[model samples]
Target: MKYLIVHDAAPGQFIHIYKHLRSEGHEVVVASRRGTTHRLPVKQLVYELPEELKGSRSGYTAKVIGLGLSLYEELKPLAFDGWAPDVILSHASRGASYFLRDLFPRARIVSLFEWYYGAPNPDTGMDEGAFRQQAANAAATNMPISRDFDCMDAGYTPTLFQRDAFPKSWHRNLEVIHDGIDTDFYTPANKRAIEVNGKRFRKGDEIVTYAARGMEHTRGFVEFMAAISEVQKRRPDLQVLIAAADRLCYDPGEKGKGLKSFVDETIDYDRERTHFLGLVPEAKFVSVLQVSSLHVYLTKPFVLSWSLLNAMSVGIPVLGSASAPVQEVISNGDNGLLVSMDDGQALADAMDHLLADQVEAGRLGRAGRETVIERYGLAQCLQRQLDLMRG
Candidate 1:
């Protein structure tokens, strides 16, 4: 079978399937924005909008359409060479492959959606200005995603929570199949002293870890720090390690400003104990988790992050926000603990409780690892993706 993979970037989550198809003697091609994948067949796509068309900041919808059209122009050569794929697995882009349908009419296009950005978190009371910004953001991001959904033969989301976020009409076409984690790579490590970024993190050290792609409001960084502040007052020996860059992934309010401006200015942080290892390598990230007494993850009903699962896979007790996507994975007091993101004192209390109760923490850690192995393990998910891509 001829399988084509379309993504804003690849072989991201699709790496396992991409390698599998080639080893199985199937014709596979990847089209993405990356420059090269060494031996793998790929058509690198890059299109810069003309400066003359960069007139208004209000024309975000038009700008996104240009990006989609650019993707189509870059990918037509594959079809021109009489190499139309039987299936296309497109991921996380605003109709990047929607125009490809004209060339590969027979191919089944399955778009992988992380989440449909429907509305801002209900708890976050929006003023008139905030409401207008939310609407504009939707136009720039969600509008294009809606276009992709309209053209896809099927939609695949990682979790049921994410699937349910889409319009009710799309539910029939949507399927939930997580791009799973590598169990072997992310396994329970032997507890020991590990040195990272010139800091020696010793075993038995009271350390709390927080990780995300960036330090932003959406990831609950501000609230995490607030909780951390409370925990600091309780545990004098506790050390905090944050593994993310100072930037915004979501939350446009924090974009132009940085970590200094993004986080709540009033939260009293234990700056001496707090270490911000800005965007460490994956191996280092694992080291941080390995030394962690407790791992904290939070999201505002947004796309589920891999760091949370990675910490779980690493066999550490994790505390996640009680948001829809997180609640889907963590069973409070069982596999993992959960807290309302709005309640900073409650979060701090949970962290303090976990730290004090090592026996319960260990149990939760083991259960969390078991959850990952059984549900989101790579072996099963890879097979499912292979079937979909080869269909």
Candidate 2:
């Protein structure tokens, strides 16, 4: 089968699935905007918008209209070059290809749906003020996207939580298949000592870890820091390691300061005990999890983070926010523990419990890895995706 994947950026977890398709002798081509397209093991076509469509209110509006046209225009040359695709897959947010159905009338077009926001959302369900108003306004931005989706052949989402976020009408075409984790690579290892800043941490050291793409309120950075201070009051021997960019991604306003600023304002914990590894390499991250006594992950009612699954795959006990998305993966007292995102005291208590009970922690950690191996294995996810694409 010939495949044409349309994305705003490079293939992320789809890289593994792409390789598998190529290995099976299927031809694949990627039409991307900002990725190392030449470096990927596939034919590539590039599309880009003018530089003016960047970083302003008017620019954002121009980008939305211009990007769709640019993507469609770039692919016209490919069609002229005699490269016909059997299927077209694209991110739902990139509504460009929704207009190109006439060009590939025979090909099935699948939208890789992620989030669909509207009023009364889970993210603002507990809100009492401006958050609710902001979320409702944000949902209006999806009007054009919802109209474009009407022309899609099918839709696929990584989770039921995300799938349900869309209108109930589209649920029939939307299927849930997570971007799986590589269990073999993420499995527990007895790395006897992990060195950080010239200090070696042996097996028995009490280490606590919090990792994310960014230190944002959506990930509960403030709550995590407050809990850390409370936890330190009880166990000053605990060593903390935070791995994330120091800025916000979802909400980038001045009020959305980094974790350090939050810590500086609210907490008085010993700075010497905490280490901010500010987005380290994969090897270093895995080493941190391997040596960790407990791994804490907090998030609003948004998409589940892959870091949570990665930590679980490494066989470490995770204490995650008791939100819908996180709750879907973690079963309390089974694979991992869940703490109320609104309760700082409960967060500290859960962390202390998991860190103190080594026997129970080990049991939960093993179960967590088993969950990943059984349900979210990479090979299984790839096959499931292929099946959806074939349909």
Candidate 3:
């Protein structure tokens, strides 16, 4: 079937889903504002937004109303040229769904619900009033998407956490199918000898911790740092390797920015135990996981990170935050260990325990790999998506 997917096209969740749909033999077209220059394997249809609309304020009420008209005007011609679509799958909520429905009256329009308003902002320090206003705008804008649910053929979400976030009435057409991982690319490997940044790391010597692009409050970077310090105090020989995409570089004098500089000032950097390698290739990331003795993944109650799942696929013992999506995947003391969201001591203790007991860690890692193979593998996810579309 021909499918048109509208999303931000950032280097995260949506990209994997895009690639997966293409691999399943669907004629996929991505409508995105970012990564215009980045080459993708499938057919891509770009939508350019004005600078004002693409800014952080675009989610506001006035800004969305203005941008909605502009987006409709820009995408009309592309929809005609593409011969319309069999199904228009959108992650951009109401605006894109409404525009697509107007353009392709015959096509089934499905929206992927990654988030909803009214939920607590996982990011700390966000002004409540501003956040509430953003939510209000989102609710207003997303009405079109929700309204189309009955008219459209079907809708799908990656997790139950996302589905339950919406009102029960709106989720009538929603189906929960996980955005799965490619097991071949992220399979279990022997942690013998691995190198990062020209430094050789042995299996038991290095402990790799990871967080992605946004190092903001939502990702629990501060808590990860605190946990690292706690672990270091006990195990002085531990070498912490941090692999991140967007490393926060803050001004030294900023009082309460909640930036990376704040972490630098609080932690004892002189020990030289922590190394931050900014944005390595995918192969290198898999290699880091292969050689890691223990991997710490901390986050607030947001969408689960793909890295954690990738690590699990590779049979690396993961210590993740006990939040919604993460908790759904990790069963404490089973496949992987789960710790409280802001509990630094618990995170540190779990890390130390996993590291000290290699036998138990190996067992958990093996179990995690089995779970990925049995349930969350690419084949299973592909079949589920096909079923969703066919239904």
* lDDT of every model, 2 decimals: 0.80, 0.79, 0.70
Q: If ranked by TM-score, best first, what sequence of candidates would result?
A: 1, 2, 3
Q: Residue-wise lDDT of candidate 3 within 97-191, one digit each (tens)?
A: 44566677888766566655553364966688867765565576556556556556777778787777777886766888777888898876664
lDDT of 1 by residue, 1-391 (tens): 8887776656676778777777888777776653533445544445444455455663766666665677677767766878788887777565566576776888888788876666556467878778777866765677767777877787688899989988889888877889889889888767667765577887579999999878778899998998899999999999999998888777765354446454546778887888888888777777788889999999997889889999999999999999999999999999999999999989999999999999999999999999999999999988887666555
The TM-scores, one per candidate, come to 0.90, 0.89, 0.84
lDDT of 3 at 363: 96
State candidate 1's TM-score: 0.90
Top TM-score model = 1
Ranking 2 against 3 by lDDT, winner: 2
Best by lDDT: 1
Candidate 3 regions off by >4 Å?
A: 10-26, 35-37, 41-43, 51-59, 65-71, 78-82, 119-152, 191-193, 247-258, 269-271
**Between candidates 2 and 3, the TM-score winner:** 2
Query: Runs in model 2 with CA error above 4 Å?
Result: 35-38, 59-61, 94-98, 120-137, 252-259
The parts of candidate 1 lying over 4 Å away from their true place are: 34-43, 47-58, 119-130, 261-265
What local lDDT score does residue 178 receive in model 3, on the 0 to 100 scale? Answer: 75
